[model samples]
Target: MYIESFVEYNYIGEIAGLLLSGLLLFVMLYVRPKKTLLFKYIFNGTILSIVAILFQISIIKVANNPDQYYNKNLFGIQLISFLLVYNGILYCIFSYVNMMSVVRRNQRKEFILMYAVLSIIYVIGIIIEIAASGLYTFTLDGIDIRHFTRYYISAGIVCAVVCFIASALNRREISRITWHAVCLFVPTSLVVLIGQMIYVVKAHYIFSATTYVPIFMIGFLLFHNVPYDELSGTQSIYALDAYLMKNMGKKKIWVVYVILKTLDIENFIKKDIDSLYYGISICRNLENLSPSLRLYKMSDNKFVNILEESDPGKAKLIIQEIRGIFDKSRVDLDVPFNYTIIAGELRSETDTILKVRQFFEFISKRFIDHNSSQFYITKESDYKGFSEHYEISSVIRDIRLRENLDDERIVVYAQPIYSVGTGSFKSAEALMRLKVGDKLISPEVFIPIAESSGAIHMLTCIILNKVCRAIGSFSEYYDFDAISINCSSKELSMENLNRDFMEIIERYDIDPSKIRLEVTETAMFENYERANKNMESLSSEGIQFYLDDFGTGYSSLERVMNCPFKTIKFDKTLLYKSLHDDRMNDILSYMIEVFKKNGFITLIEGVEDESQKTYSVDRGFDYIQGYLYAKPTPIEEVKKFFNRKSSF
Candidate 1:
């Protein structure tokens, strides 16, 4: 076949090679793949290729102008060219093997041995070929070009065979591009070498440019295609998402959110090469427990283990094994890192992918301040309406971002609190409710949002004002004593605590004596002095104060005594425990007596049935507040239904 003249084609190939190789280097540097070490070696390999090309150009210039520069440097140039091109190929092989070692953990020892053997072979080849026979190349016209020597052929063959074997061994473990690299790299390189030999025999200067084409292809094929983290060898978050989505219904998946407890996550990620060692050690420990635990790194300090059909007990054992890694008495690593791991487990059913996503969303918001590193197992029962939770979170985010709540969206619910003995509607506790387009958001969901976003104070004020308006309206029909409103610790902590309470109360022009304020015992303990001051200040204004959820706190009696409470509402947990124990029942009865003697009205919450109500009233409870009377209802509904009941 006829081709273009040697001189023209040679110049085109050289210029084309330079431009393409430079572009490869630029792109590689720009992307900055995770395997920085591998990137460095590839970078060195590229630089060597460029240097070999420059040496060929220099030799061409000197050969043309025979007396312009020293001719003796030609041998040195050839020697250097041989060394660079030879080691450049070796470096490529080294990077591939290293990647295989990282992806498949057990192959590390075999990889190391293979690497040492390859290194020895390359060094011996370079010393024998370059130092003794001096690269075995000849000048074509004026340009010093390259051809395959016995050393080059032998070393390349050994490297290719070993690489092909490594790729075959890790066929399933490595990515498609990596597999393609293993398959294509050796053949392409051998083809280039053969072309170099043919071109040199035909007296052409094309080998230098042609040889680098395969190297550039190898760089693009391997570096960009690697799918796992360069440092940890764990699946990247992106890869995990894709895998989970692809195998959506095929696996019984459980995600274990792993967090490092001892060291700050940012610091752990930023502390140089130690991060790699720590990650490897943790992964090793996890793998030792169960090979099916596919670990993925979620962030700098958080790892996720995706298990197929793994039970909670197995996950717990894996966490325990990881924790044992840091124990000085149990195991010693080369670089012993000070890190402790805590894991949270959530299982996903076939149709519950949305639930897992919602869980991830919830933990993302709360996990930073969570210092406890214990393993927490979460099932569907823990968060039944996962989509609703996600919606609530989005609502919270919107609320926080907007910082203005539509008062129309805020609601007040009231549950009737009746007298245990008379079965009369005595009073009702005003409960806070929020709704978004008819979807009622539980206080359990939005209250935390309020507390976190500094909106609890506003929420309390809204509730108090709404209750006041509702009570004034209800008073025209019913003979109830008062409508009690719940106050949060955030509301009590307000600097204008007294004024805030009175501003709403006085606006409604309601009787202060008829308005009761219920504060949780735990709320008072949050800031005792401030809570006491707020309670005393409100009490001085003729507002009756009740210590709500009394037995739930550590110091119930102390709170009542320090704060001037008119009543102490016993939590139902106390009642439930007293059921099986006669001693507990007696002690509860005695406590009620003691409170009544001290001028404190004792009320028991959670009276669900007639028997509980009878038991409580017989035990000296001044009032009973629970579903035995009614669930929380809107003010309008409460008026119509209760008026009928009273008439009946």
Candidate 2:
């Protein structure tokens, strides 16, 4: 059957497309953020498209010079080239869908197997088309038009339909860039399909489909693939934020936050490559645990997994499995490593990316403070704890911003310290109390949050100012030697700590001698140089520094002696344990003697009963502070203890 073939091939347009696609390929490879697995797939598709375009250009060249290559079986070669071009275009479409599946983390074994089957069928069809059509009839009118069978056309339609179905099924996972590319692709593809049908009816050559390959490649590079950590190959925190914002109300997500504490130490010691390898290994193992898990590396030591899970129980089970993975890794590795995992179901109805990030920080701080391996915010009570922490953080932020001591949200209480030598209440420790509505939030609960959030310095300054006020107000009537204020490690490391403290004490016209700063052994050890400098500068101004929570930290006696501390406050745990164990009692006595010999005033806190206080006094402790003398109370309530002396 002969027909009037009017469709003409545009060699110039085809060549322009080939050049543009090649340039885009160069740009993609040169400027890609990372050579991720997804990038490799897209890169392969681009290369295939470029090859297809080259084949189309070669066929056009051969057809134009028909007489020059007449003996080359030109028609058969053109037919094979046409099929190969369509095959490349179809593979590109499949690759786009595969990248989307990768982002969604829903690429299951079944999906992969189906893809493999479709690919095999498509390739086999190409082979069959070539074998079945060794020679094709052609009319060498103006342009050498090949009259081919409908095998390639039919196979292309079926493959295109399969790709369309696969893409539709994962439409939700398609990124904005992919959607835009699809929007452009649909109209172009329709035009190509309509033109191909027209060409077939008119017995003309079909145009190449590689013209728009660069569009998809550019879109994928610019909009689709998110930035990932170079070391761990996990998405960045910014990507997580974007993902959360994009999928907020669309699906239920549970975040499994993992922190490798040992890896953090490793990173500090410049073993970053090894730490990242360990982190990447953990991520791979976690990804293997679930098909719908997407991991993001939030920081050096922290990883976040977004699980598409609706049930809290199931999420907890997954988290437990994750903990087991970490535990097993610790046991399997040559070096011992410790890890913490905290998982909580995201409230899609009300949670924002910021809130989710804050939730992560809150739980991380809780884990560090409690030293627990795993935590699941699956229960209402657990969420309530988070809510309380959020509220307390808000209160602290308000206090810091307002700088109003009269707000009453932040209150200060004083616990009296009894002097064993003079047998009188000679000193008091200023403690922080946060009044949230009617109930008081414990320091144990909010202190770590404050420290983690960088609000501890503000809290420290407020407490110092309030204590100075109290000392100035009650010193006329009270006979206390000094009021001790607790300083956190974060506060001690502050470069402006001395300036902030001196300003407050100077403002109230209180003697620096009347203000004693209580620092934990851990705090001093955290940034020894800065803490020591701050302590020495403050001590030189007549403010005594007390090494608080002595036995709770790892500090050598020589280090403690070199520190500019006037006193050592033994922790309650040491006192309680020493009372029960005779060996501990001897060690405690020896420590007190050593400190006293070095001209350090020694105090044993947690002296509750008569026996404990008597043991403390007999051991020659200079001071005692505990519940047995006086529980922490308001500055006004502590006045009665000023004149009272310990019976012991």
Candidate 3:
């Protein structure tokens, strides 16, 4: 006989059992199982199976006769114990099979049937063990034990076979590492389970070896493969970053950064469970819409879609499809929400992973400040044929890469402001221009960068001081009335704005009356008291203030009335619309009359044609400024412009 005797079996079982128990403890504590349901079942089954083997080892110690021919009570206890442990193992296997099926997007009817059949078999085996039980009482090699039942062992073998087959059929549905781990478990478990049934091995050794191997495999797989987000099943940011880096230089890839407008982030996070379900629901909706669009969570109320389409038009079409999804389902959210998607091509040649991440940051800052719910497409058209597909991200990248801090690259251009009555140039607005080598950077590009970098105030000071010096240097050459410099919201809120203005004017030795500060109504409305105080302080010092782009902000007429602005400038969009529409002209005339009655000078900007200029003059506008007079020119060019016109 090859099997061990009673004393030898006990010695081997205790030594081996203690070592396996330590391994289990080490894996459970160090490897640390994931909180997934499949892992939970596997962990529980492992603990129960190990305990069953321990019970089998201690059976002889508790029995009345160690070498007895029969012990009915011990037999019943061992039969019931092994049967329960086998059933648990089978149940865990079924659970894992179901999990694989769901992940594979397969019909789970087969898994359901398998679970039902296995449950019935386990119930029958338990019944048989309770009603009729006996111990194998032969001292073959002096080892006393019960024969391993065919029913219980066969059930375990069937489960192993089913798990192996499922894994093979759904190979692509599983990760390579995960599939390999499953393969390591299923074959070894099946062979050991069958070997125990046919030959007499120590039951403690068979169960412990089979269960420990699979459990360790599962723990290793879970520890290494990180797929789902901690809060939901969506792909995590870590996965997103990895995928982006892998496809970084791939051609014709596009990513759309989506912002959920009106989403209350604080409230959503407060209700964490609902928020997790909300994220899952969003992923489900995206999957239902287009599985090709892989959604990744970017922020609390933001998501991104990465796709590989050669044509940007196809990406746009996908964006429209996502819009349709949002339209159909937004009302179902617990709170009202809408989406603003910013999309462009993910260029290969010039972009890196860091540049792409910076692009997202730029989009997020713009979305918060604008609070707009419309799709903003920064397509190839904006790049002027630099590439077949260009993105706004490149523009942001250029701005960040710029190292022009000393303001040497900054230039001031003057656009003539003409008197409507005389049609003669008197004042000119100082527009800030940035140049990189010979290329002129658009205000649309640099202004937002300035705002985001917290350098708008510094940029304003630079422009203001430069404009003053330029005008002061040329104040003798031409009888110029005043030069208006644009001020951003940040500049108006500066505590030392009044001092900054006075010091610059004093340094240039220029008359404060010759320099006007131009502000938009939005700036005044955002910080009304600060703006009002600064406006009064500067106006008292002989510097004038003009409300630029009036009627385009959220401020009411009453709020505008309280500001110490001496002039009001109409925005180009409002002027053009009023010029084309008779109803809007009547409203425009009413606006002009209201400002005129309040002793405020009204200037209508964007008068680019004879008809537009005629309308501004006919409406009794105090001043007119647009391409109709002259495009923005340098300070020297402005002097020559008036010198050549003879109107000055």
- lDDT at 517 for candidate 1? 88
Against the true structure, whose TM-score is highest? 2
Q: Which candidate is the best by lDDT?
A: 2
- The full ranking of all candidates by lDDT, starting with the best, is 2, 3, 1
TM-score of each: 0.61, 0.65, 0.60
Better of 2 and 3 by lDDT: 2
- Model 3 lDDT tens row, 1-648: 334445323335344654665566567667554555456655665566566566655553433244553355755677567667657666766665546433432355666676878688767866765455343443433434434345566777777787778778866444433465677767777766676665444342333345344554454344323444322334556778888778767556777778777557766544554544454455555655554566666666777777677766777888777766666556656766667777767764337776676655555554676644667766455334333112333443454456333366677788988886665788889887766557677677778667766667666677777788777767776776888999898779778999977877898888899989899988886778888888899999998889999878877788778888889998988888887899988999998999899999999899889888788888999998999888999855676554333443
- Model 2 per-residue lDDT tens digits across residues 204-263: 444544334754565455443455432233677788888998988888888888876663
Candidate 1 vs candidate 3: the lDDT winner is 3
Residue pairs whose backbone atoms clash in candidate 1: none
Model 3 residue runs over 4 Å out of place are 1-225, 229-234, 247-351, 354-405, 416-427, 445-483, 488-516, 522-544, 552-555, 572-589, 607-620, 628-630, 635-648
Error of 1 at 399 (Å): 6.0
Off by over 4 Å in 2: 1-34, 37-215, 218-224, 227-350, 354-377, 397-407, 474-479, 636-648
Error of 3 at 161 (Å): 5.0
How much is the lDDT of residue 115 in candidate 3? 80
Question: lDDT at 603 for candidate 1?
Answer: 85
